[model samples]
Target: MSMSLSTLGALIDTDHMLRACCNNPKCRHYAKLDLEYLAVKLGRDHSSMRDDLVPKLKCSKCKSKNISLILSAKSTEGLGHT
Candidate 1:
Protein backbone atom coordinates (compact mmCIF):
# COMPACT_ATOMS: atom_id res chain seq x y z
CA MET A 1 0.00 0.00 0.00
CA SER A 2 1.09 3.52 -0.65
CA MET A 3 1.18 6.24 1.92
CA SER A 4 -1.90 8.42 2.02
CA LEU A 5 -1.17 12.00 1.01
CA SER A 6 -1.98 13.43 4.43
CA THR A 7 -0.24 10.60 6.25
CA LEU A 8 3.24 10.92 4.81
CA GLY A 9 5.81 11.66 7.50
CA ALA A 10 3.13 11.79 10.15
CA LEU A 11 3.88 8.55 11.92
CA ILE A 12 6.24 7.02 9.40
CA ASP A 13 7.66 7.62 5.94
CA THR A 14 5.75 4.71 4.42
CA ASP A 15 2.28 3.23 4.75
CA HIS A 16 2.26 0.79 7.63
CA MET A 17 0.15 -0.51 10.45
CA LEU A 18 1.01 0.21 14.05
CA ARG A 19 0.42 -2.07 17.00
CA ALA A 20 1.00 -1.11 20.61
CA CYS A 21 1.64 -3.55 23.40
CA CYS A 22 1.63 -2.89 27.10
CA ASN A 23 5.02 -3.31 28.73
CA ASN A 24 3.70 -4.11 32.17
CA PRO A 25 4.85 -7.56 33.30
CA LYS A 26 1.43 -8.44 34.66
CA CYS A 27 -0.71 -6.85 31.98
CA ARG A 28 0.40 -7.14 28.40
CA HIS A 29 -2.47 -5.61 26.51
CA TYR A 30 -2.21 -5.28 22.73
CA ALA A 31 -4.02 -3.09 20.24
CA LYS A 32 -3.90 -1.92 16.65
CA LEU A 33 -3.75 1.79 16.02
CA ASP A 34 -5.35 3.59 13.13
CA LEU A 35 -2.66 5.60 11.39
CA GLU A 36 -5.11 8.00 9.79
CA TYR A 37 -6.85 8.73 13.06
CA LEU A 38 -3.55 9.35 14.78
CA ALA A 39 -2.36 11.56 11.94
CA VAL A 40 -5.46 13.70 12.06
CA LYS A 41 -5.65 13.80 15.84
CA LEU A 42 -1.99 14.50 16.48
CA GLY A 43 -1.28 16.72 13.42
CA ARG A 44 2.23 18.22 13.49
CA ASP A 45 2.99 16.62 16.82
CA HIS A 46 2.92 13.21 15.16
CA SER A 47 6.31 13.58 13.55
CA SER A 48 8.53 11.13 15.36
CA MET A 49 7.38 7.57 16.03
CA ARG A 50 8.97 6.91 19.42
CA ASP A 51 9.36 10.46 20.62
CA ASP A 52 5.79 11.52 19.94
CA LEU A 53 3.57 8.48 19.83
CA VAL A 54 5.04 6.45 22.65
CA PRO A 55 4.39 9.04 25.32
CA LYS A 56 0.72 9.28 24.33
CA LEU A 57 0.00 5.60 24.75
CA LYS A 58 -1.38 3.71 27.69
CA CYS A 59 -2.54 0.15 28.16
CA SER A 60 -6.29 -0.23 28.01
CA LYS A 61 -6.32 -3.04 30.54
CA CYS A 62 -3.84 -1.95 33.18
CA LYS A 63 -3.72 1.70 32.18
CA SER A 64 0.05 1.54 32.24
CA LYS A 65 2.02 4.14 30.33
CA ASN A 66 4.78 1.68 29.54
CA ILE A 67 4.19 0.51 25.99
CA SER A 68 6.10 -0.97 23.08
CA LEU A 69 5.41 -0.49 19.41
CA ILE A 70 5.27 -2.84 16.45
CA LEU A 71 5.37 -1.80 12.82
CA SER A 72 4.00 -3.94 10.02
CA ALA A 73 3.71 -3.35 6.32
CA LYS A 74 0.32 -2.08 5.26
CA SER A 75 0.30 -4.57 2.41
CA THR A 76 -0.06 -7.49 4.79
CA GLU A 77 -3.84 -7.47 4.61
CA GLY A 78 -4.49 -10.84 6.21
CA LEU A 79 -1.61 -11.32 8.62
CA GLY A 80 -3.38 -10.25 11.76
CA HIS A 81 -4.70 -13.75 12.42
CA THR A 82 -2.51 -16.73 13.38
Candidate 2:
Protein backbone atom coordinates (compact mmCIF):
# COMPACT_ATOMS: atom_id res chain seq x y z
CA MET A 1 0.00 0.00 0.00
CA SER A 2 1.10 3.55 -0.64
CA MET A 3 1.47 6.21 2.05
CA SER A 4 -1.40 8.57 2.66
CA LEU A 5 -1.11 12.35 2.75
CA SER A 6 -1.91 12.25 6.44
CA THR A 7 0.67 13.40 8.99
CA LEU A 8 0.59 10.02 10.68
CA GLY A 9 3.53 9.20 8.37
CA ALA A 10 4.18 6.92 5.41
CA LEU A 11 4.70 3.93 7.64
CA ILE A 12 0.96 3.66 7.98
CA ASP A 13 0.58 3.02 4.27
CA THR A 14 2.94 0.11 4.49
CA ASP A 15 1.88 -3.39 5.41
CA HIS A 16 3.32 -3.06 8.92
CA MET A 17 1.23 -1.60 11.76
CA LEU A 18 1.85 0.36 14.98
CA ARG A 19 1.28 -0.70 18.54
CA ALA A 20 0.41 1.42 21.59
CA CYS A 21 1.45 -0.28 24.73
CA CYS A 22 0.86 0.46 28.38
CA ASN A 23 3.56 2.67 29.86
CA ASN A 24 3.03 1.18 33.26
CA PRO A 25 5.18 -1.88 33.48
CA LYS A 26 2.56 -3.63 35.59
CA CYS A 27 -0.25 -2.90 33.16
CA ARG A 28 -0.27 -5.53 30.47
CA HIS A 29 -3.20 -4.09 28.57
CA TYR A 30 -2.03 -2.64 25.28
CA ALA A 31 -3.84 -1.43 22.20
CA LYS A 32 -2.52 -2.79 18.91
CA LEU A 33 -4.18 -0.34 16.54
CA ASP A 34 -3.05 0.83 13.15
CA LEU A 35 -2.70 4.47 12.17
CA GLU A 36 -5.70 4.14 9.89
CA TYR A 37 -7.81 2.48 12.54
CA LEU A 38 -6.68 5.00 15.13
CA ALA A 39 -7.48 7.90 12.85
CA VAL A 40 -11.03 6.67 12.44
CA LYS A 41 -11.46 5.89 16.10
CA LEU A 42 -10.21 9.34 17.12
CA GLY A 43 -12.11 11.11 14.36
CA ARG A 44 -8.92 12.45 12.85
CA ASP A 45 -7.21 12.28 9.47
CA HIS A 46 -4.28 10.43 10.98
CA SER A 47 -2.62 9.28 14.20
CA SER A 48 0.45 11.44 13.81
CA MET A 49 -0.46 13.67 16.73
CA ARG A 50 0.50 11.79 19.84
CA ASP A 51 -1.00 14.37 22.20
CA ASP A 52 -4.45 13.87 20.72
CA LEU A 53 -4.39 10.16 21.48
CA VAL A 54 -2.63 10.18 24.82
CA PRO A 55 -5.47 11.74 26.80
CA LYS A 56 -7.92 9.35 25.20
CA LEU A 57 -5.74 6.34 25.94
CA LYS A 58 -6.00 4.27 29.08
CA CYS A 59 -4.55 0.95 30.11
CA SER A 60 -7.36 -1.59 30.18
CA LYS A 61 -5.64 -3.60 32.87
CA CYS A 62 -4.51 -0.86 35.26
CA LYS A 63 -6.23 2.15 33.76
CA SER A 64 -2.98 4.12 33.77
CA LYS A 65 -2.64 7.45 32.03
CA ASN A 66 0.99 6.67 31.14
CA ILE A 67 1.33 4.84 27.86
CA SER A 68 4.03 3.79 25.42
CA LEU A 69 4.09 3.70 21.65
CA ILE A 70 5.60 0.90 19.62
CA LEU A 71 5.98 0.49 15.87
CA SER A 72 5.26 -3.05 14.90
CA ALA A 73 7.21 -4.88 12.21
CA LYS A 74 4.12 -6.77 11.17
CA SER A 75 1.93 -5.00 8.69
CA THR A 76 -1.75 -5.40 7.97
CA GLU A 77 -0.93 -7.44 4.88
CA GLY A 78 1.59 -9.81 6.50
CA LEU A 79 4.97 -10.19 8.14
CA GLY A 80 8.53 -10.76 6.81
CA HIS A 81 8.03 -8.06 4.22
CA THR A 82 8.43 -4.73 6.04
Candidate 3:
Protein backbone atom coordinates (compact mmCIF):
# COMPACT_ATOMS: atom_id res chain seq x y z
CA MET A 1 0.00 0.00 0.00
CA SER A 2 3.04 2.26 0.16
CA MET A 3 5.45 3.34 -2.56
CA SER A 4 9.22 2.91 -2.29
CA LEU A 5 11.48 5.85 -1.54
CA SER A 6 12.84 5.94 -5.10
CA THR A 7 9.34 5.92 -6.54
CA LEU A 8 8.29 8.70 -4.23
CA GLY A 9 11.33 10.71 -5.19
CA ALA A 10 10.57 10.29 -8.88
CA LEU A 11 6.99 11.37 -8.36
CA ILE A 12 8.05 14.42 -6.44
CA ASP A 13 10.58 15.37 -9.11
CA THR A 14 8.04 14.95 -11.89
CA ASP A 15 5.38 16.97 -10.11
CA HIS A 16 7.73 19.84 -9.37
CA MET A 17 9.34 19.87 -12.81
CA LEU A 18 8.97 22.98 -15.01
CA ARG A 19 9.61 23.59 -18.70
CA ALA A 20 12.49 25.70 -19.97
CA CYS A 21 10.60 28.99 -20.13
CA CYS A 22 8.04 28.34 -17.43
CA ASN A 23 9.83 30.75 -15.05
CA ASN A 24 8.14 29.17 -12.08
CA PRO A 25 9.51 29.18 -8.54
CA LYS A 26 8.97 25.47 -7.76
CA CYS A 27 11.24 24.04 -10.46
CA ARG A 28 14.80 23.82 -11.80
CA HIS A 29 14.26 25.94 -14.90
CA TYR A 30 16.56 28.55 -13.42
CA ALA A 31 19.50 26.13 -13.27
CA LYS A 32 19.14 24.84 -16.83
CA LEU A 33 20.60 26.38 -19.94
CA ASP A 34 19.34 26.02 -23.49
CA LEU A 35 22.82 25.38 -24.72
CA GLU A 36 22.11 23.84 -28.13
CA TYR A 37 19.89 26.63 -29.39
CA LEU A 38 22.24 29.17 -27.91
CA ALA A 39 25.20 27.59 -29.68
CA VAL A 40 23.53 27.73 -33.10
CA LYS A 41 22.77 31.42 -32.77
CA LEU A 42 26.13 32.35 -31.32
CA GLY A 43 28.13 30.21 -33.82
CA ARG A 44 30.04 28.74 -30.89
CA ASP A 45 29.56 26.42 -27.93
CA HIS A 46 30.87 28.77 -25.31
CA SER A 47 27.60 30.20 -24.00
CA SER A 48 29.18 32.35 -21.34
CA MET A 49 30.49 35.01 -23.73
CA ARG A 50 27.71 34.92 -26.31
CA ASP A 51 25.82 38.19 -26.24
CA ASP A 52 22.74 37.88 -28.40
CA LEU A 53 19.04 38.38 -27.84
CA VAL A 54 16.92 35.25 -27.43
CA PRO A 55 13.54 36.22 -28.80
CA LYS A 56 10.63 34.73 -26.89
CA LEU A 57 6.92 35.54 -27.12
CA LYS A 58 4.80 33.68 -24.63
CA CYS A 59 2.33 34.05 -21.80
CA SER A 60 3.46 34.43 -18.22
CA LYS A 61 1.82 32.71 -15.23
CA CYS A 62 -0.39 35.80 -14.85
CA LYS A 63 -1.66 35.23 -18.44
CA SER A 64 0.05 38.41 -19.58
CA LYS A 65 1.84 38.78 -22.90
CA ASN A 66 5.53 38.27 -22.13
CA ILE A 67 7.86 39.32 -24.91
CA SER A 68 11.57 39.02 -24.21
CA LEU A 69 14.35 40.13 -26.54
CA ILE A 70 17.43 39.94 -24.40
CA LEU A 71 20.44 37.76 -23.75
CA SER A 72 19.58 34.10 -23.21
CA ALA A 73 21.67 33.93 -20.03
CA LYS A 74 19.59 36.62 -18.39
CA SER A 75 17.68 35.67 -15.28
CA THR A 76 14.19 34.49 -16.20
CA GLU A 77 13.49 33.36 -12.64
CA GLY A 78 10.48 35.39 -11.60
CA LEU A 79 9.89 33.72 -8.22
CA GLY A 80 13.52 32.64 -7.64
CA HIS A 81 14.96 29.09 -7.77
CA THR A 82 13.02 26.17 -6.44
Candidate 4:
Protein backbone atom coordinates (compact mmCIF):
# COMPACT_ATOMS: atom_id res chain seq x y z
CA MET A 1 0.00 0.00 0.00
CA SER A 2 1.12 3.59 -0.73
CA MET A 3 1.91 5.80 2.29
CA SER A 4 3.62 8.96 3.49
CA LEU A 5 5.69 10.15 6.48
CA SER A 6 3.53 9.62 9.52
CA THR A 7 3.90 8.30 13.03
CA LEU A 8 6.06 5.27 13.57
CA GLY A 9 3.09 3.55 15.15
CA ALA A 10 1.05 4.22 12.02
CA LEU A 11 3.86 2.92 9.88
CA ILE A 12 4.08 -0.17 12.03
CA ASP A 13 0.34 -0.60 11.82
CA THR A 14 0.43 -0.37 8.04
CA ASP A 15 3.54 -2.57 7.75
CA HIS A 16 5.28 -0.07 5.51
CA MET A 17 9.02 0.24 5.21
CA LEU A 18 10.66 3.35 6.56
CA ARG A 19 13.68 4.65 4.68
CA ALA A 20 16.10 7.41 5.51
CA CYS A 21 17.43 9.26 2.47
CA CYS A 22 20.47 11.46 2.57
CA ASN A 23 19.58 15.00 1.59
CA ASN A 24 23.09 15.82 0.44
CA PRO A 25 22.94 16.37 -3.31
CA LYS A 26 26.21 14.53 -3.87
CA CYS A 27 25.53 11.68 -1.49
CA ARG A 28 21.98 10.48 -1.85
CA HIS A 29 22.29 7.43 0.29
CA TYR A 30 19.22 5.43 1.19
CA ALA A 31 18.80 2.93 4.01
CA LYS A 32 15.99 0.99 5.59
CA LEU A 33 15.21 1.44 9.25
CA ASP A 34 13.52 -1.06 11.49
CA LEU A 35 10.24 0.39 12.68
CA GLU A 36 9.71 -2.09 15.47
CA TYR A 37 13.18 -1.57 16.78
CA LEU A 38 12.80 2.18 16.59
CA ALA A 39 9.49 2.05 18.37
CA VAL A 40 11.04 0.09 21.16
CA LYS A 41 14.12 2.22 21.32
CA LEU A 42 12.56 5.63 20.85
CA GLY A 43 9.45 4.76 22.82
CA ARG A 44 6.01 4.45 21.27
CA ASP A 45 4.86 7.93 22.16
CA HIS A 46 8.03 9.72 21.01
CA SER A 47 8.20 7.87 17.75
CA SER A 48 4.53 8.25 17.11
CA MET A 49 4.80 11.97 16.51
CA ARG A 50 5.14 13.52 13.04
CA ASP A 51 8.64 14.19 11.70
CA ASP A 52 10.12 13.74 15.15
CA LEU A 53 12.72 11.27 13.97
CA VAL A 54 14.06 13.20 11.00
CA PRO A 55 16.18 15.58 13.02
CA LYS A 56 17.97 12.66 14.62
CA LEU A 57 18.88 10.93 11.35
CA LYS A 58 22.31 10.96 9.77
CA CYS A 59 23.55 9.61 6.45
CA SER A 60 25.85 6.66 6.98
CA LYS A 61 27.70 7.22 3.71
CA CYS A 62 28.30 10.97 3.99
CA LYS A 63 27.79 11.35 7.73
CA SER A 64 25.48 14.25 7.09
CA LYS A 65 22.60 15.23 9.33
CA ASN A 66 20.53 16.31 6.36
CA ILE A 67 18.14 13.44 6.02
CA SER A 68 14.61 12.89 4.79
CA LEU A 69 12.10 10.20 5.61
CA ILE A 70 10.26 8.21 2.96
CA LEU A 71 7.78 5.37 3.07
CA SER A 72 8.10 2.39 0.76
CA ALA A 73 6.17 -0.82 0.46
CA LYS A 74 7.43 -3.58 2.70
CA SER A 75 9.69 -6.08 0.96
CA THR A 76 11.80 -9.13 1.64
CA GLU A 77 14.98 -7.41 0.52
CA GLY A 78 13.92 -4.17 2.17
CA LEU A 79 13.78 -2.48 -1.21
CA GLY A 80 10.33 -1.75 -2.54
CA HIS A 81 9.13 -4.18 -5.17
CA THR A 82 8.68 -2.85 -8.69
Candidate 5:
Protein backbone atom coordinates (compact mmCIF):
# COMPACT_ATOMS: atom_id res chain seq x y z
CA MET A 1 0.00 0.00 0.00
CA SER A 2 1.07 3.55 -0.68
CA MET A 3 1.51 5.89 2.26
CA SER A 4 -0.19 9.24 2.12
CA LEU A 5 1.78 12.43 2.26
CA SER A 6 1.86 14.20 5.64
CA THR A 7 0.06 17.48 6.24
CA LEU A 8 1.51 20.67 7.70
CA GLY A 9 0.17 19.88 11.17
CA ALA A 10 1.84 16.48 11.05
CA LEU A 11 5.14 18.12 10.13
CA ILE A 12 4.98 20.55 13.06
CA ASP A 13 3.97 19.17 16.43
CA THR A 14 4.44 22.47 18.33
CA ASP A 15 7.95 21.30 19.21
CA HIS A 16 10.39 20.23 16.47
CA MET A 17 11.47 22.57 13.70
CA LEU A 18 10.89 22.31 9.96
CA ARG A 19 13.04 22.95 6.93
CA ALA A 20 11.74 25.28 4.26
CA CYS A 21 13.23 24.97 0.78
CA CYS A 22 12.66 26.83 -2.43
CA ASN A 23 10.99 24.70 -5.07
CA ASN A 24 12.57 26.65 -7.92
CA PRO A 25 15.12 24.43 -9.63
CA LYS A 26 17.46 27.33 -10.25
CA CYS A 27 17.17 28.55 -6.68
CA ARG A 28 17.16 25.73 -4.16
CA HIS A 29 17.90 27.88 -1.11
CA TYR A 30 16.55 26.71 2.23
CA ALA A 31 16.09 27.87 5.83
CA LYS A 32 15.33 26.13 9.11
CA LEU A 33 12.66 27.68 11.32
CA ASP A 34 10.42 26.95 14.27
CA LEU A 35 7.14 25.39 13.25
CA GLU A 36 5.07 27.60 15.58
CA TYR A 37 6.69 30.75 14.23
CA LEU A 38 6.05 29.67 10.69
CA ALA A 39 2.40 29.10 11.51
CA VAL A 40 2.14 32.57 12.96
CA LYS A 41 3.81 34.12 9.94
CA LEU A 42 1.19 32.54 7.72
CA GLY A 43 -1.66 33.75 9.95
CA ARG A 44 -5.34 32.71 9.77
CA ASP A 45 -6.95 29.65 11.26
CA HIS A 46 -5.24 26.28 11.42
CA SER A 47 -7.54 24.80 8.83
CA SER A 48 -5.95 24.62 5.38
CA MET A 49 -2.89 26.33 6.82
CA ARG A 50 -0.59 24.54 4.40
CA ASP A 51 -2.48 25.87 1.41
CA ASP A 52 -2.41 29.35 2.89
CA LEU A 53 1.37 29.28 3.33
CA VAL A 54 2.10 28.37 -0.29
CA PRO A 55 0.95 31.59 -1.92
CA LYS A 56 2.51 33.75 0.77
CA LEU A 57 5.84 31.91 0.83
CA LYS A 58 8.40 33.25 -1.61
CA CYS A 59 12.03 32.38 -2.24
CA SER A 60 14.43 35.11 -1.27
CA LYS A 61 16.63 34.47 -4.30
CA CYS A 62 14.18 33.52 -7.05
CA LYS A 63 10.98 34.91 -5.43
CA SER A 64 9.04 31.90 -6.65
CA LYS A 65 5.88 30.31 -5.24
CA ASN A 66 7.39 26.86 -5.49
CA ILE A 67 8.32 26.20 -1.90
CA SER A 68 8.67 22.91 -0.09
CA LEU A 69 8.53 22.03 3.62
CA ILE A 70 10.03 18.99 5.31
CA LEU A 71 11.23 17.71 8.67
CA SER A 72 14.64 18.89 9.80
CA ALA A 73 17.58 16.78 11.04
CA LYS A 74 16.15 13.29 11.07
CA SER A 75 19.54 11.85 12.11
CA THR A 76 21.75 12.59 15.10
CA GLU A 77 24.81 12.68 12.89
CA GLY A 78 26.93 15.76 13.74
CA LEU A 79 25.49 16.47 17.16
CA GLY A 80 27.92 16.03 20.05
CA HIS A 81 27.01 13.61 22.82
CA THR A 82 25.95 15.02 26.15
Candidate 6:
Protein backbone atom coordinates (compact mmCIF):
# COMPACT_ATOMS: atom_id res chain seq x y z
CA MET A 1 0.00 0.00 0.00
CA SER A 2 1.17 3.52 -0.81
CA MET A 3 -0.20 6.96 -0.14
CA SER A 4 -0.73 9.39 -3.04
CA LEU A 5 1.35 12.53 -3.44
CA SER A 6 -1.65 14.67 -2.44
CA THR A 7 -2.03 12.64 0.73
CA LEU A 8 1.60 13.19 1.60
CA GLY A 9 1.27 16.86 0.83
CA ALA A 10 -1.85 17.10 3.00
CA LEU A 11 -0.02 15.48 5.88
CA ILE A 12 2.86 17.91 5.54
CA ASP A 13 0.47 20.83 5.33
CA THR A 14 -1.35 19.66 8.45
CA ASP A 15 1.94 19.41 10.33
CA HIS A 16 2.94 22.89 9.22
CA MET A 17 -0.43 24.34 10.24
CA LEU A 18 -0.20 22.69 13.63
CA ARG A 19 3.29 24.04 14.13
CA ALA A 20 2.11 27.48 13.09
CA CYS A 21 -0.81 27.31 15.48
CA CYS A 22 1.44 26.21 18.32
CA ASN A 23 3.89 29.03 17.68
CA ASN A 24 1.16 31.69 17.51
CA PRO A 25 1.70 34.42 20.11
CA LYS A 26 -1.97 34.56 21.03
CA CYS A 27 -1.61 30.95 22.09
CA ARG A 28 -1.97 30.61 25.83
CA HIS A 29 0.89 28.15 25.99
CA TYR A 30 3.52 30.37 24.38
CA ALA A 31 4.26 33.93 23.26
CA LYS A 32 5.28 34.33 19.60
CA LEU A 33 3.38 36.98 17.64
CA ASP A 34 5.50 36.63 14.50
CA LEU A 35 3.56 33.55 13.46
CA GLU A 36 0.27 35.42 13.57
CA TYR A 37 1.81 38.33 11.74
CA LEU A 38 3.00 36.06 8.97
CA ALA A 39 -0.38 34.40 8.75
CA VAL A 40 -2.05 37.77 8.27
CA LYS A 41 0.60 38.90 5.78
CA LEU A 42 -0.21 35.85 3.68
CA GLY A 43 -3.85 36.98 3.38
CA ARG A 44 -5.25 34.10 5.40
CA ASP A 45 -8.91 34.36 6.35
CA HIS A 46 -9.67 36.04 9.67
CA SER A 47 -11.85 33.12 10.77
CA SER A 48 -9.05 30.67 10.16
CA MET A 49 -6.67 33.03 11.85
CA ARG A 50 -8.97 33.19 14.87
CA ASP A 51 -9.11 29.40 15.02
CA ASP A 52 -5.36 29.06 14.57
CA LEU A 53 -4.21 31.94 16.76
CA VAL A 54 -6.95 32.95 19.17
CA PRO A 55 -5.70 34.60 22.31
CA LYS A 56 -5.65 31.87 24.93
CA LEU A 57 -5.43 34.23 27.82
CA LYS A 58 -8.61 36.05 28.66
CA CYS A 59 -6.46 38.68 30.31
CA SER A 60 -3.31 39.57 28.45
CA LYS A 61 -2.25 41.93 31.21
CA CYS A 62 -1.86 39.39 34.01
CA LYS A 63 -1.84 36.04 32.18
CA SER A 64 -3.45 34.36 35.17
CA LYS A 65 -5.41 31.17 34.85
CA ASN A 66 -7.67 31.88 37.84
CA ILE A 67 -7.82 35.67 37.83
CA SER A 68 -8.21 38.27 35.11
CA LEU A 69 -5.23 39.33 33.00
CA ILE A 70 -5.01 42.50 35.04
CA LEU A 71 -3.29 40.68 37.91
CA SER A 72 0.20 41.96 38.52
CA ALA A 73 3.45 39.96 38.85
CA LYS A 74 5.23 42.46 40.99
CA SER A 75 5.71 40.32 44.13
CA THR A 76 6.34 37.06 42.33
CA GLU A 77 10.11 37.48 42.48
CA GLY A 78 12.42 35.03 44.25
CA LEU A 79 12.43 36.56 47.71
CA GLY A 80 15.04 34.08 48.91
CA HIS A 81 17.46 34.73 46.09
CA THR A 82 21.00 35.28 47.41
- Number of the predicted model whose TM-score against the real structure is largest: 1
C-alpha-based local distance difference test score of model 2: 0.62
Return the lDDT, model 1, position 18. 83
Model 5 C-alpha lDDT per residue in residues 1-82, reported as the tens digit of each score: 6522243454454334456799887889997745566557654244333465567667778888788866554454357866
Q: Which ten residues in a row have the lowest lDDT in candidate 1?
A: 3-12
Considering TM-score, where higher is better, how would the candidates rank from best to worst?
1, 4, 2, 5, 3, 6
Best by lDDT: 4
Kindly report which residue stretches of model 2 are placed more than 4 angstroms away from their true locations once superposed: 1-12, 34-36, 75-82
lDDT for 5 in candidate 1 is 31
Q: What C-alpha lDDT, on a 0 to 100 scale, does residue 45 get in candidate 3? A: 26
The TM-score of predicted model 5 comes to 0.54
lDDT of 3 by residue, 1-82 (tens): 7632122133232332223343333431222334444435543323232122223323334332322322221244455757
* Alpha carbon deviation, residue 20, candidate 2 (Å): 1.9
Total backbone collisions, model 4: 0
lDDT of 2 by residue, 1-82 (tens): 6656334545455545656788777666777765676656755544454565668777777889787766554533454565
Error of 3 at 38 (Å): 0.3
Clashes of 2: 2
lDDT of each: 0.71, 0.62, 0.32, 0.73, 0.59, 0.33
Question: What residue runs in model 4 are displaced by over 4 Å at the alpha carbon?
Answer: 1-6, 48-50, 75-82
Model 5: lDDT equals 0.59
Q: Between prediction 1 and prediction 4, which has the larger TM-score?
A: 1
What are the TM-scores, per candidate, against the unseen true structure?
0.70, 0.56, 0.22, 0.68, 0.54, 0.17
Candidate 6 lDDT tens digits, 1-82: 7632122233233333222123324543433233345444533333332433344323243453322111112244356788
All models, RMSD in angstroms: 4.7, 4.6, 15.0, 4.5, 5.2, 15.7
RMSD of 4: 4.5
CA shift at 46, candidate 3, in angstroms? 5.3
5 against 6, candidate with superior TM-score: 5
